[model samples]
Target chain A: MKNNTTLLRVITYVVLISTTSILINDIQEFNFEQFKSFASWSKSVNKNENWFTSKNAIMWSYYIIITALFFWRGYLIYGFTHFVSILKEIEKENYFSQKNINYFKKIGNVFITYTINVLVLQFLLSVIQGASFNFFKELKNEFTFLIPCGLAFYLLAEIFKRAKTLKEENDLTI
Target chain B: MPITVNLDVMLIKRKMKSKELAQKIGITTANLSILKSGKAKAIRFSTLEAICEALECQPSDILEYKP
Candidate 1:
């Protein structure tokens, strides 16, 4: 158990660190310069001042949608932290504790939420930028695997709940 | 929940303390308390056999099915 827990902890740490650093790298690479076009358009439209007629609305929307995507990536990373909490419960011999069950459900919620929101935002951004958005191609991305994994975590939580009741009954049985 | 344990009655008849019975049967006092208090869901055959041996009573004496 110790060996397995240690190995799992290491793997989780590596995943969290790599993901977070990758996100930070993307944020650094994000171009505020893209919004520069919106600036000249902003001045040009000052007489009319209608955002709809602004020449750079698409670029602005693209930046906004991409930034939202980055935040959702951060949200997904937050979900991964719950795995550490679940591992902590296991460390204390509380494999079926309510806290662990809640953590599992929470992770499932986060994974599904992040995936669905990211997909929607990506689609919307593509529509704004006049890019072709392929649903199956997006599904083939590595992150899409989290959907099944999220469902699996919810299943684990339900199974743990049943096991907890059985364990309590067994403990009281003499 | 309908099935109740009458371990306390058997313990009294056998003139044995709960702690003593728990010791003889190789179970903790807390668990024996759970059984005596009718909080236990089920009893294992090995534990039931040990309890019967310790109390010199039948399983029916220590367990009752009340409607």
Candidate 2:
């Protein structure tokens, strides 16, 4: 059991590191300089120009949506940190501990929230770019799996809650 | 809980210590404490039988329905 937990811990660490580096790389590739310039432009631009239809307005909205998407991605990565915590609990022989259950619920919330928020951001991005948004086409993407995965985590939390109760009952039976 | 344990009362009647009864019944003193404190959710039939056999008392003597 210790070996299995160690192996799982290693795998989780690898996944966490890889995803974190990828997110960092993506952030580096994103044009923060352009966002800064946009901010400067907004400060000096013609105040009389229509706010909704101007090119600068569209650019600002685009940057805002991209930033929000990045934020949600970071949040999803934060959710992955809970796996390490859960493994630590298991290593301590606390299988149905309240901490682990709460971690599962939090992961579920993060997963569902990240997915939904990203989808909305994508639709908004498409709209800002004057592209048609296809909802079904978006759902066909890989991250859509997070929806069901989130629900599974919620179910796991509920199961752990039940198991905790049963364990307590068993312990007190005598 | 609706059901209450009267194990301490039965122990007094039988002039038995909690540790001695736990030893006789092959259960830990901690578990006996749980039973005595009415903290146990449910008692197993085998354990109830062992306690009865050790105390030489009826099951009703150790368990009571309060509500």
Candidate 3:
């Protein structure tokens, strides 16, 4: 299990590095023509007409990145807090204290929040990519894809809520 | 769910105050209170052993089966 975890960590870093490299490449190759096409496409949609402009698109990307980073940090904070608590509980040899159960709930909450943020970003990226290429035919496809993401978010929230309730009961008993 | 704790009886027999027992056992009064009130979900064997040694009693003196 330890070896598998290390391998997973390595794979995650590799993926992150590759993704950052690709994003840098895309930013370097960015051109005014793409912006013009995107702006024109935005004008077609009443909801995001202003967002199609070059400046607005850049601002939108920044906003998305900021929101994503904030939530990502929140997820990390909750994850680390829960992890430390679990370690402390284990150190105290209090397995029946249900502290780890509370930590599991925290992990679930973080996972759900992070998953929702990623899903929203993916939806926005799909819409932006389709609009830039004038792919109106695939517009409905993006909205439909969000349904499962929403369901998964709801399921995770419910699971965490149940776990939290159990933890509370355990705490009360103690 | 209906387990019984005889912490109070043992403390009384030893003529030891809860606060003093807590201090001697390196645990907080709050935790000692929880144990005395039979609300503790679990207790570490080491903690149980320490309490028994400090009070010079057996586990049966501090814990009992009620259900």
Residues A24-63 of candidate 3: C-alpha lDDT, one tens digit per residue: 5655764546456556756765773554678667656845
Question: What value does the lDDT take at residue A41 in candidate 2?
Answer: 80
Residue-pair clashes per prediction, in order, are 0, 0, 0
TM-score of chain B only, all predictions? 0.94, 0.96, 0.93
Candidate 3 lDDT by residue in tens digits, B1-67: 5678888888888899999999888888898898888777788888888898899999988878877
In candidate 3, list every pair of residues with a backbone clash: none
lDDT of 2 by residue, B1-67 (tens): 8898999889898899999999999999998898899998888999999998999889999899988
* RMSD of every prediction: 2.4, 2.4, 10.0
Summarize candidate 2's per-residue lDDT along A40-143 as a digit string, tens digits.
Answer: 88788888977776786778788888888876778988999999999999999999999999999999999999889889999999998889999999999999
True contacts kept of each: 0.95, 0.95, 0.25
Choose the strongest candidate by lDDT.
2
Instruction: Identify the superior model by TM-score, candidate 1 or candidate 3.
Output: 1
How well does candidate 2 match the true structure, expressed as C-alpha RMSD?
A: 2.4
Model 2 pairs whose backbones collide: none
How do the residues A1-174 of candidate 1 rate in per-residue lDDT, one tens digit apiece?
988998999999999999899988988987868668667766766575555645456667777887798778889899989989988888888988999989999999998888899889999988987899999999999889999999999999899999999888777666
| Candidate 1 chain A lDDT trough over 10 residues, lowest sum | A48-57
Off by over 4 Å in 1: A47-61
